[model samples]
Target chain A: MNQGWTERQRPPRLERRLEFADYETTRDFLDRAALVSERLGIYPDMSFGRTYVNITLHAQDDATEVGEPSRHFAREIDILLETEKTLDE
Target chain B: MNQGWTERQRPPRLERRLEFADYETTRDFLDRAALVSERLGIYPDMSFGRTYVNITLHAQDDATEVGEPSRHFAREIDILLETEKTLDE
Candidate 1:
């Protein structure tokens, strides 16, 4: 439950949908997010359209709670999106 | 109507699921597919996890038929996959 992220219960995961003005921005966000995953060793499931990407960070292992790692990954994604926006400004 | 593509009538979409051995290969295919969309002017919705991408090309202009353009785009995706495989060899 961090800002725009919604935490789901049954199958625990943090989900967020990010919107962009164009595909170029969307692609940039995606490419950078992938790098972040590699850096932090946390890969999320992502689905995208021309100007939007939905990211889901599922809880690690067989745990029943949305824990620290998912939160950290979500924070990283938030930072990534802000970094892209800052670059545009 | 392609080898791996299945046409869905209700939503009028041609859907295909592509499996990759690794994340790098998945990223390669996604990148190449984006380029193809730009080159061919046909965009399809893609959803992916760690090792698989599900692509759905919806019928254009509200038509009930999965038309030629959708088929052409699917063909391009198949070629893109093959092109990556060739590079890997």
Candidate 2:
């Protein structure tokens, strides 16, 4: 499992929750994450509130493991968040 | 509650699950939905798989109602799905 993600046993998914300072930043991150998902052709289950975003990536096909694509997507998400933070600063 | 959506009791939110024919279509709909959320300034908690997308919209503040924005967003989502179906035909 990745640092921020918790592995779910029943359905076999990797889940992560990220918190931001405020609503607009959280929403902006979601928008950017959506664009990244589109570009990468891999989408995560996502939920958000005023200050947090939750993402879950399910293991495909009976693999029982969070595949490379999911890992890559998660890493890319980290990068996106970092970039956004840099831009905000 | 809306036709395709269910009201969740504990957290007081509106939830819906939509099924598509294939993975590509599911992802495409997600991309479109993200754009709609951005445009509307309201985001849903979203999750998806090869053929299904699940969404939840939480009621803000202490209000137990789904609120105007969530309802409007849901209606717009229906319109988006209908428009996509027509284009696919």
Candidate 3:
């Protein structure tokens, strides 16, 4: 994460951000995220501003206790971003 | 979509829903969708209710006009759902 931008070159804002609370949760997570972006006037596959950025999310959670009470745990989010202009438009 | 359940077996409610405005936009779409789920107390990777359902989204937008003004168009949404009890709990 935050590997591309140099310390001085990175902007204060994130082009796109994806966070999740568990693993293999991308399917459900993405659904809700897209809904939010649409409400915010940002529709996926639709260009926004002058730049095209893609962000991804991957999440995982695990809590296993045989005899004791089960404790929930999750940490799985994968984000991928790309900069490009719309080819069709 | 909705191919698994027989007509009689299908429920009136959707286990999960994923809708998008374009194609190959999973990265950004998923990010925003997940955010919305979290706010809805349905954080990704976290079990909810008695069933585990996974929903996916795939969107595509295309507008090609050589001499005319471009008109935005998009229609890409894939949804998947699964019913299973939690193993850990």
Candidate 4:
């Protein structure tokens, strides 16, 4: 539903891919994202390489649908990324 | 190619799913795996929930096939897991 996220059908998940200039930046982003996830009490499924990170939030559950918490978590991540960008500048 | 890992066809990747007793153990395993990946100079695609971590090592590339580095990397991860298991005991 967001600009960078794709909704997948097979597993019913919202996915996003992020690319960074280097591995350090990518790792830093992941560390921050982990902290955010811990605070939010929700963890997105995550995959990463040297300069790329992919995150997925499942959309379907018995109690929740369409990844409501996941979307909120993504927004929080976006804020963290923005704050990191501002600091880098 | 080894126990606990499955070879997938769609994207041609080797995948392993690990389950932990708790989120803390899962995160600890992930942190150690990240370190091993960094030392090996190869990163696996990783996805995590509260108590499960799924990791995939791509098997196909122009220069590599069937995930040679990935299998080696997985072995390193297995070693790390063994070490952690020993520590836990």
What C-alpha lDDT do the candidate models reach, one value each?
Answer: 0.84, 0.81, 0.27, 0.80
Put the candidates in TM-score order, highest first.
1, 4, 2, 3
lDDT of each residue in B1-89, candidate 2, tens digit only? 34898888777898889999976687688778867887888877776655788888889879888899998899889899889989999
What is the TM-score of candidate 4? Answer: 0.81
| Ten contiguous residues minimizing lDDT sum, candidate 4 chain A | A59-68
- The DockQ assigned to candidate 3 is 0.03
Which one wins by lDDT: 3 or 4?
Answer: 4
Q: Could you list the CA RMSD of all candidates, in the order they appear?
A: 1.7, 3.7, 17.9, 2.9
- Which candidate gets the maximum lDDT versus the true structure? 1
The better candidate by DockQ, 1 or 3, is 1
Please, what are the lDDT tens digits per residue for candidate 4 over residues A1-89?
A: 44887877766777889999987788889888888888888877787777898888887565334566788998888788789889999
Lowest lDDT 10-mer window, candidate 3 chain B? Answer: B67-76
Model 2 agreement with the true structure over A1-89: per-residue lDDT tens digits: 34897888778888999999976687678668867787888877776655788888989879888899998899899888778878888
Per-residue accuracy of model 3 over A32-89 as CA lDDT, tens digit each: 4444444443332221111222342212123122111110101111231221112212
For residues B1-89, write the lDDT of model 4, one tens digit per residue: 34887877767878888889987898889788878877888877777777898887886565334556778898887888788889999
Residue B20 CA displacement from its true place in model 1, Å: 0.8
Query: Model 2 - which docking category?
Result: acceptable
| Candidate 1, superposed: residue stretches over 4 Å from native | none
